[model samples]
Target: MSVSNPTLITFVIYIAAMVLIGLMAYRSTNNLSDYILGGRSLGSVVTALSAGASDMSGWLLMGLPGAIYMSGLSESWIAVGLIAGAYLNWLFVAGRLRVQTEHNGDALTLPDYFSSRFEDKSGLLRIISAVVILVFFTIYCASGIVAGARLFESTFGMSYETALWAGAAATIAYTFIGGFLAVSWTDTVQATLMIFALILTPIIVLLATGGVDTTFLAIEAKDPTNFDMLKNTTFIGVISLMGWGLGYFGQPHILARFMAADSVKSIAKARRISMTWMILCLGGTVAVGFFGIAYFSAHPEVAGPVTENPERVFIELAKILFNPWVAGVLLSAILAAVMSTLSCQLLVCSSALTEDFYKTFLRKSASQVELVWVGRAMVLLVALIAIAMAANPENRVLGLVSYAWAGFGAAFGPVVLISVIWKGMTRNGALAGILVGATTVIVWKHFSLLGLYEIIPGFIFASLAIYFVSKMGAPTAGMVERFDAAEKDYNLNK
Candidate 1:
């Protein structure tokens, strides 16, 4: 079960190139700003691709395709929900958050922005938000590790423990060296590789399985339920699937791209590019899974043990469809997807620790260089924690992703959305929303309540908590002034 020499060489070259990019980015990283936010200098294309790459993670390749392979078309609602949510986040939250964060004390992290936005002198807002980020991101980071482990085990036939370390090593190295700039630059390349793999794999699968009609007929003959979109469609299922979009407004990694954009003006263009890439990539991901069903129907022998581990569909398909060298390159795209998102998550976790905790509480007078090093140290720490969590071979990448995704979306989504659009949102209201949303998610998920996704209940409760609490509390004149100024500046910029 050894890896082919050609595949090993391709992987080595890819990993080496990533490390080189980290070394190069090190020259430009002179301050904490540069280390955490790329010095707020990313262009539209890089911002769009980096954000998309970080948002998709290995779930885009492994978790997503696996879901479709196992569940048929009912799983696609999640994709549709994500596309719609992404568009709205870029449209509504991106420009406003960019201008607002810079205006409100030049806040760097999400917690920094939240504390400054409400003028929470007691630091309660900062503490709550930072804890939530660390907690959910730990789980989110574990999902990426699981995806990477699955990729290595499937492609190279390595033990899960060996594959877990191998998958995390390169990502942690680059992030430790270059920070945000390294993450963004490598993400651009990874994003390109991801799209190429998603697009090319499906096309090859279709060709090898004959035409579209023939593929469909074969799939239908094998199992008519595979093509039935309505087979498992229910009100709860559809809403829960589409609710995935709502999580976008609150995702710290994606919002970091907006905050780091060159200017508010660049966001519109970035949104268009990001959305286009997302649609094509998501469609391609679903196609790979759907086509795998057909291909396996025709040539079941090639599927091997994928019936038990359906996530291996993409890996198995590539091995059967392409030459050894080309298949190696295609498989490397999975690693690209894994690394791109894992690096960003680790960086965000670092920023939350360094900026929100260390700089704010431990040493308000710390030098920029000192803070940057602390950030790099935290990156390694968080990656190690995630690696430990991902050591379990039975973890399903999608299951981990869904839990963490719901946590972030429920905890932060309603508060973030309300903070930007509504001027009357008080500090107490923000605190209440964070606590209620996060608590609801934990409780709902732990108990497996009502046969519905935790996000639906968590999001509703959080939003309700914010509204009612804000109504009960009074906003200060200073808070009103700050909101007005942000709104005016946003309008003027537009």
Candidate 2:
């Protein structure tokens, strides 16, 4: 249970750097656009890395390792699926979103873009989408908080409740002050830290275990199944799990990065950098988990009692194998994963409440000053709700994150994709898709008798709902003209 002082020092430095970035970001904030999207001037490198890090979240630390540790190479396919999905999303969505968002005149939030694009004069679609964002993101944020608590509890020997609050407050404080710029800047730093730690820790562990061949032999001698990528992995279970990549199609924080990029041209470079980082980091995480078996077989006590909690694989390895300084760096890498995700969710949630609801409906003429205060207040509210939810301290991080993720992916993913590509997509179709998609996910997760993965049912129902509704509902002549005009203009511009 003992941890080294050097590890604590490394943590202090990482936390200090995060807070400083937030304080500096506060100086640049003057309006909603600046606070939420960095004034639409974020460069390719910052946008790409920040978005990827936030998207991966604590799952990169806790869930990925836990999967590899318990299930072995069978789980690596999830990383493969995710990388492919992310590459496609960036290629198809990033540049167009950046161009169209700016073309729509400084749309600061996702709901804002939806409202403007679909011309939701009654504000129904905007309100519905915003509510969905808040509900699922609250759960998503709570998952990150829980992961942070677990990390602190494991490394610092703190109580779960204390760690939960410390993690939430630390992330929220800087996010509240600095906003999007702060989040993006810290994400870049954290992403670098996370990648380095993931790579170095595995290499150090592999070398210490007498190289890859010996390491494999040791692991195989202990558990033959640990080395098999297809062992005990069925088609449905594999597809249902790895289909998590589909959730990327609709994640607000991820799209927010696209919307904030300095220009459309930067997206190509951004994609290359982001994909390279993801492949390397995710691959390293898988190796560390798989390699831990061999290392632990040689020296079990030093690795601690990891059989009880697979999520602690990386932390246990750090404690047993590395010097205190390197262990601290690794711990910070996990924290970086947690903080990057939490900050993004908090900002997205606050934006939904402030721009989508409070300003859009409650106070149409609210001042910039009032809007900023409202956004800050919303951040506090979202944090409190997530803290209450994370009180259990043992809720699986992937379970919580996945539930919310399915909600977003099922409800908004199809609508976003169709709206961008199909001129025939009507407002009613978009609204129908959003409602059915969101509702299906909620019901599938909590009430369905079929017992399928929520995303499977939710996604299927959502797609059908959009198609049926769009086909039955007649498009007005003006609406048809607008669609035609928009498509023609888009083609001409391209």
Candidate 3:
């Protein structure tokens, strides 16, 4: 496939800039702690943007805009749910987790945090949580890869198979090189590019389609119901869509940002900055699709790609509407979104294997330098697995994301949230919640039961299991004492 020289040059520059950032961060990384969590030294802006960028992923630019393009506003329940969930997570979970992870022995990963919080002597919590992270994160990583592949396939005219590998290459390179600091630093830049594209593309789209009113009229003329939130969906569908928010609690990549903040106080300002950025990006994403509808409806002759796969609406429109140079910059935003999230997910998976598994079981006395190298190796290993998962051309980014999101939300959300906030929650309770939540999501998704999203059932059941099982058992004195110290520290910090 012949590519536009301008776009090809832009992509080259963008990818190089990302790698340069990774190289810069490599100098700051000296130990396993630095590699995995930046030694918890991230300031407010870096922490906030990294959290937001990593959380959004390619799904923000590709899957989400595609979903809105095909299903109209009815699909935005996920967006609404996500915005609400993220805000709550920032408010309730961020500070507590930062303080708790520190007090719990300077934990670097979610599984480590869980194991330390519950005082589990048997290593069950660490094993199960780490496995869940690996399992769901593999799927989550695949979604980012698929989104990147789609972007590459459409933009550069690469075949699906070629695009899959090409799409994951840059992300894996930098993540392997720079570790957490690199991922976090690059994320801030990517987040800026993403917001720029999202904000700019939509305004251009609006102008191209005449205006907001004209766009609405075009949509209304085609299908008035397109503007309706519950247009073709059942109440169950609405509930399912909104359930996406619950996944925020269990996302390891986002939580890692919270844990990496310079201080608990940093989280306060980071929350405000993150939320503002998120709201703007999401609003702009919807605008891209909403306005694309009008622009395409009037120019059906050039809408073949979008008509064939609605997910390509943004990609197609970006190329058609902008000058070649501007289009190159706008299109790089998709790559930015893909790299930001994929890098962090790779780092989190790396952290899980290195901190939760290898360091814990293989070499209890492993050197910091050895552990950092091991983390870098794990990032490559997981990226390969995810690339294999994304090899199929028919895979949809949103579909892959939904399953993984449900899995994490169900398996880790209740456990993480309850463990930090409640002192009386027992080890057995945490274990039960993890099992029940993960099982429910897998089983519910397999059976297609109730036409409801799995996260809702999984979250509810997990929360219930923790409550009942904790009521049945009690925590040890040491457990309570540890919780008291963590809680007191959190209070003082907050």
Candidate 4:
């Protein structure tokens, strides 16, 4: 429980640096565009790292490793799904979305894009999309809080209650001070820290356990199934695991990186960089968990006693493998993962409330400066909600993340993909898709049907709803014309 002074100092310096970045970013943030999308000026490196950092979150460090440690190679399916999904998203969706969103009314947020893309004069589409974002992201943000709390609880030996608030406070301060720019910049830094920690931990663990062969032998001795990829093979399970890739298309935080890219041309380079980063980071994370099984099996005394929560494997290994100062920096990487994603989630929610709700409904005439402050307030509001939701120390980061990921993927993934690619996608169909996807995910999750992941059913039904409803209702000439123009713009850029 006793953290060395040097370790405590390291944590403080890292937290302070994030806040400093926010202060610096605040100076350049002049309008909602700057606040929400960094004036659409992020270069390839920032865009790629920001998107990677925000998308991976604490789940990458804590949740994924824990799942791998607990369930063995079977959990790697999620990583496989994510890599494939991320690549496709970059190849098919990123460049087109970057071009089309800018062309379609210079949209600042996803809700703004949805409303503009479909020419929904009734404002229903914007409202529905914004609601989905707010609802799912609130839960999504709570996963980060849970991850942060877990990190703090393990590292600093703080109470869950104190750790929960402390963990959230640094993220809130930085995000509230600056908006998208701060989030992006901090994310770049966090991504670097995360990759460093992920890569180093596994390598050190492997050396400590003698080598890979020894580690494998130890793990196999503990449980032969640890190496069996087909231990619990099922068609539905594989499909469900791969379905996670579908969630990337709908994740607003990740999409915002694409939307904020400096140019369509930048997306190609960013995509390459992102994929490379993702592959390395994911591989490292899985190794940490898989290797931890061997390390602990060889030296169970280091772990103290067996616990149900295998998520603690990473933290326990860090403490045992490294000196106090080195462990502090590595542990801060977990906090970095937590803060990076939490900041992005808060900004996305704030953008929804500020641009989609406030500007649309209450303050159409509000000045840019006023709206920025309102966005800050909304960031605090959402952070408070997520903190309350994450108050239970028993809450698993992966479980919360999976639920929110499914909600976003089902509710908005199909609609976003179809809207960008299909000109015939009617506003009515968009509405139906969102409603059906959101509703189905909630119902399927609650009812527990066939033990299938909710996203599989939700995505299928939502896609069908969009296709059928759009066929039932014709698109207006204006809608068709606008779609033509956006399509033309996309092709021209290509």
Deviation of model 1 at 68, angstroms: 1.0
**Tens-digit lDDT string for candidate 2 (427-484):** 7888999999898888777785455567777777777887788787665565456555
The 10-residue segment of model 3 with minimum total lDDT is 1-10
| Position 241, candidate 1: lDDT | 88
For model 2, state the Cα shift of residue 224 in Å: 1.3
Q: Which stretches of candidate 2 lie over 4 Å from their true place?
A: 1-4, 447-451, 474-494
Model 1, position 278: C-alpha lDDT score: 93
Model 4 lDDT tens row, 335-373: 999999999999999999999999999989999999999
**Model 3: CA > 4 A from native:** 1-4
Clash number for candidate 4: 0
Off by over 4 Å in 4: 1-4, 305-308
Whole-model Cα lDDT of every candidate shown, in order: 0.91, 0.85, 0.91, 0.92
Cα error, residue 365 of model 1, in Å, equals: 1.1
In model 3, the number of clashes is 0
lDDT of 3 by residue, 1-494 (tens): 44548988888899999999889989999999899999999999999999999998888888888888887888888889999999999988999999889888788898888888888889999999999999999999999999999998998888999999988999999999999999999999999999999989988888888888888899888778779999899999998998899999999999999999999889899999999999999998888877777888999999999988888887898899999888989889889898999998899999999998899999999998899999999999999999999998999888998999999999999988888889999999999999999999999999999999999999999999999999998998978888898889888877
Candidate 1 Cα errors over 4 Å, as ranges: 1-4
Candidates sorted by lDDT, descending order?
Answer: 4, 1, 3, 2
Error of 3 at 208 (Å): 0.7
